[model samples]
Target: MSEEVGRTAQSGWEVGVSRTLPYSGARLWEFLLGREGVEVWLGAGVELPRERGEAYETANGITGEIRSFHEGTRVRLTWRPKDWDHDSTLQLTVVGQGRRSTLKFHQEWLADAAERAEQRAYWKDVTERVAAALAER
Candidate 1:
């Protein structure tokens, strides 16, 4: 099935969201795994062993696909949540901006309007918390 196929037993679709963090790209990747990392961000529900192709999981039962991981630089994964039929593509990017860094996040997972709305709310909450965490450091 293509990426657009509906869930195994569903008739609806979902949407995705893009968010930006206050920190540079490198720190965002690191923060997802550091002690304060899990405590601050929404990704990395489960710890990634920092190896490509390792099976990672989230606390919410979302298994992850560590497609690309570069020590302290970047990561892209397939994030699966029990509530959705398809796993969204989650990507992280770190870039230098002036005197600071920018963390860019893109998530393409969900297949229903309602699900998209709910996921948006979920990310909004996480974004605020993550911003604070990055600010403190």
Candidate 2:
């Protein structure tokens, strides 16, 4: 992996994906941020806390803590991998569209070239899976 040189080194990688969820922005945020709801979609046994700074853990061991939330609009969390940078944050944006909503994903802090490339695919898959699961419900 090529290490980023310079101040931009800290900026990290940012990838975004959009999906249509059959729920409103408020409903979408509730499901993504809820413990049971997260487990049903984000991951198994996922524990997502509503309070900022609170950590969300899952059975697969992916843990993310709340960094910030904007009611039914956006939610930002620092997803910490045991072996990766703890500063990484995944920002999720929810856009209301009539009775449904558009979900946008922004995964930042993915630096290491090798890891970034892998995650570029992983995040896309994750978002697609989420959309499919939501579509089924």
lDDT per residue, candidate 1, 11-112, as tens digits? 234333445665555567667667676545544455565667887666777776777876655677777876656777666555656445665555564666
User: Which digits, one per residue and each the tens of the lDDT, describe model 2 over residues 1-98?
Assistant: 66553214445666667888778877787766666456644577766666898877767767878988787788788776666655577787889998
Local distance difference test values of all predictions, in order: 0.62, 0.71
What local lDDT score does residue 56 receive in model 2, on the 0 to 100 scale? 74
Mark the regions of model 1 whose C-alpha exceeds 4 Å error after superposition.
1-25, 43-45
Error of 2 at 31 (Å): 3.4
Shift of residue 48 alpha carbon in model 2, Å: 0.9
What's the distance in Å from true for residue 50, model 2?
1.1
Best-fitting candidate, scored by lDDT: 2
TM-score of each: 0.67, 0.75
